[model samples]
Target: MAMRASMHLVKSRTLLACAKEESEYRVRHPENSSPNARVLVLGGTGRVGGSTAIALSNLRPDLRIIVAGRNREKGASMVATLGGNSQFAEVDIENVKSLEAALKDVDLVVHAAGPFQQAERCTVLEAAIQTKTAYVDVCDDTTYSWRAKSFKDRAVAANIPAITTGGIYPGVSNVMAAELVRASRSESNGEPERLRFYYYTAGTGGAGPTILATSFLLLGEDVAAYNKGEMIKLKPYSGMLNIDFGKGIGKRDVYLLNLPEVRSVHEVLGIPTVSARFGTAPFFWNWGMEAMTSLLPAEFLRDRSKVQELVQLFDPVVRAVDRIAGERVSMRVDLECSDGRNAVGIFSHRRLSVCVGNATAAFALAVLEGSTQPGVWFPEEPEGIAIEAREVLLKRAAQGTINFVMNRPPWMVESDPKELGLGIYV
Candidate 1:
């Protein structure tokens, strides 16, 4: 099939990009030097999880990979694709006993089992603490991420290391925001006043049912944003802004979403104002989301079982749109300073599946390289992945990226903005 060929091409190119940096990566993160590291990828049967497993296997051939999930056949299938260095584990994340036993041998656990919205507890995190294993998760839910953060002392007490929201948007995007802030301050002594995250994905970026569930669940929660050093709440999908996402993926309209990175970045990076917005392609999809959020009762949308039915209803349609959209994904992080200047970071990829894998694998490598300490933390913590480690992580995460740039002025990336006389544009 043409689609299959296209995917093969992208993946092959992605491997080459990652391979180009392999030597430098090994040198910089020598903790991955040994042959003893083991990784268990929960939800390994699914899209994001499975892709991360493949990326990790490619990045660190020395580490043993475990493709874990509730389905035996799917896990086995994923492990087979990972070739000789991988095995399969049928483990239920919600079942602590099974999870604890699985963690008995895993040096690290990449918790990709997500759409972490509407979740009641951080059960997998608790199990990892019990087993004393180093961990990372691709959680994007604000409430869930904070819940995971609540276990900071427990993780430290158990001498375990953990990272939450270590996937694409909240994961790599978090670091991008941090890097922009650091660069602005260092370059021009600009005090970071406002930070905004804008993301655009064409038709779910090939993400599946779990992500759909996550989206539906998120519509029920009140949106959170920091405005001029104050916390404020707004209706989901209310604040709309037309953002330019740089070349390869130009301008698109985005609306406010209650993403985890909004609060975490505001708190972690010390920015006075922070918010995140996301938009999808074929424009009508945005309208549908607005309609759904408006028409559906918050309580009904909050129910997990009900959300699952809605996911089932929409998955096929999303998949069709995804096939047509070709999985392009882009994220732009912008920083506004008190000194009246703006800087931005842009990341655009042709395939979200490929990029998501690489982004998450970068985080996993950080934990494996001992970049994170024995405590629960977000990806940007200096004690976690650290600022110096960021460049290396970005290098790995940006492999096969169609476009990647950071710490540039607004005029450089924007297609068009108002221009004033004598180059003194505001």
Candidate 2:
């Protein structure tokens, strides 16, 4: 009862304050794009990678982009679509020699190539540190993100700016949580008690084969969450939650997933509790996913070779379903505080593909603008994105976003909420 009482919310339109502050920041500080910056995007043939390429091209008209991948045809296609400012390079991320060759003469390297599940090593990050090039990756895997984090000292020694888990859900969502916590503590005397990340994406998120593999592989792992300053373990897809994502994307039933951000935010923000959950549209996908964990062995799902086969088998069907679902995605982050105050940050987009590209592109721009220090870090760290650059990063990332709200109560964004008498709500 005391825990519930402490979490009671005070409704205030803090979202407008957050937005106004950001707008003011943008106006006062003109963006400074890195001079003669040439970025190499590994896995540029794929959806997430290609999106990052396009976004980078859009954000920095003068910057040069090299779409690096093994597939010549696809890389050429990406380069062609990226306008004359882009070129194609045939390089494989898994091959160290090829990566080394590609890293030469590049000002920055954007590793947008992965679901990052089951990766054996932080090879790309190692290469980036060795080459002393500014680096960023859209890695979403829990183990891989930490492995990348472990290179912080090494990155500092080499004086290379590196950021991992810099994608949409893990990336922007992580930032949102950080901002909310910052606001709550600053505006009021509310100390953040719980931080819950809720995400929803429609069919494959327009992310294609790599994402499909990530989903299958994630089901094999157990969810790691925090509560009341204590660690807790829960099975993935358990602890279901229905969260409203505002208009364009409505309420979604999300389940706990072992995402890297959960742990990253918990540690970085010093929050007592942090857990992340994800849901997909058409609901049956959730059912099918739940079924997989029960029907298949964890060991089988853990195998990359076996997981790749499943990705191939379901790729066609998922593509078909994606045509129907259209890849819309939404994320809502809630922050409950000790002084009966709660706030949320919400971001919604028509298509995950475009939004993801913009998010990654924003991170790239931040790195180029010298928004980071010489070390590997997560998106929310001051050393990672620089405290001053946070507003700019969010503004750029939210370019195409349909609805992005921060530090507001649920009633402001959600069309319908559990309303009570006397202007109170659940």
Candidate 3:
């Protein structure tokens, strides 16, 4: 009992220290705070975008928010929910003119319209660059993220900051890995060796057909993971492991996926062995995904139109399952060093629909606050997220998380922490 109490006290003190440091940093860097920023959210009618708009309003009520999308009724409805400081903009991402027109006056724009998979062009990003507007995206596709990064020189030339893969798992999760790697190096916690990302969500995470489509698209791509500084390709959803997400979420089976963070973290953080795995609830979903990879042609799965058709066919059934499974989301990041030191970071939220928005909004806020430099960068890149602002970013992203811990020992954050001897845990 005393040991548990001691551990709890340590955790509390750590969190309090982080909060204090962030608070003091904010006070010292008041220029980073933008109270009257005008933000535009593309795909504002969609689940992730709508949630991001709402979360942004909740975080900064004074900021002007423009919900931009094709459907006026849906956009207007979203605007109404956001109250007076918000309005709806008729914009189509496919039309560069529409995108540029909408982004012309906004201080920042969040591109949340995605299955980012199989996307050939960064249209909105190009428009943002053309208009010199600040940009952030909830992109989770590896190719798309790299494609966005290819525009770094142009974004710098335009004097605009852009972040790709800035959503929940790839977004906050990437940041979490960065924090872990940073701490491991700074504290001399052995030579950092392996970094693994494990994610579990219930149903479609309440994000609707878009997320379902993203999942289908992922199955079409080959998984890229790093091993001992070497890049390797493996079948998607092939390697499975059971991970304990601590409180609220227990142990769940996760499988390797072609997540963007695996590459970004490996490259940016310089981790030798890095991989990312994800799993969904009801168990059968896992089986079905694996089945799809085997039964369906890779080309069919990669085709966005075909994926959308599949989503339409399965949306109702998926929605019904989602209600029963609930919208719980948990991400566990593990880092192991050569000297047998293991550090873990976990973020668990009851509603992925809401948490994803909060997470994306956190990144958007960081960009708006000038924490990011004028270029396209991944979440782990220091230029993308200033080291000093990382704590604040994580705190904001984890606003409503049921369990959010960083830079803790694996035993401390594990659901079933093993006891060795004399109060020692491993």
TM-score of each predicted structure versus truth: 0.90, 0.90, 0.90
- List lDDT for all candidates, in order: 0.82, 0.81, 0.85
Give every collision pair in model 3: none
lDDT of 1 by residue, 363-392 (tens): 988776656667889887776676667888
In model 1, the clashing pairs are none
lDDT score of residue 110 within candidate 2: 93
lDDT of 3 by residue, 183-203 (tens): 988887588898889999999
lDDT of 1 at 26: 49
User: Which regions of candidate 3 are displaced past 4 Å?
Assistant: 1-32, 414-426
Predicted structure 2: lDDT:
0.81
Q: Which regions of candidate 2 fall more than 4 Å away from where they truly are?
A: 1-31, 414-426
Best-first order by lDDT: 3, 1, 2
Model 3 RMSD in Å is: 9.8
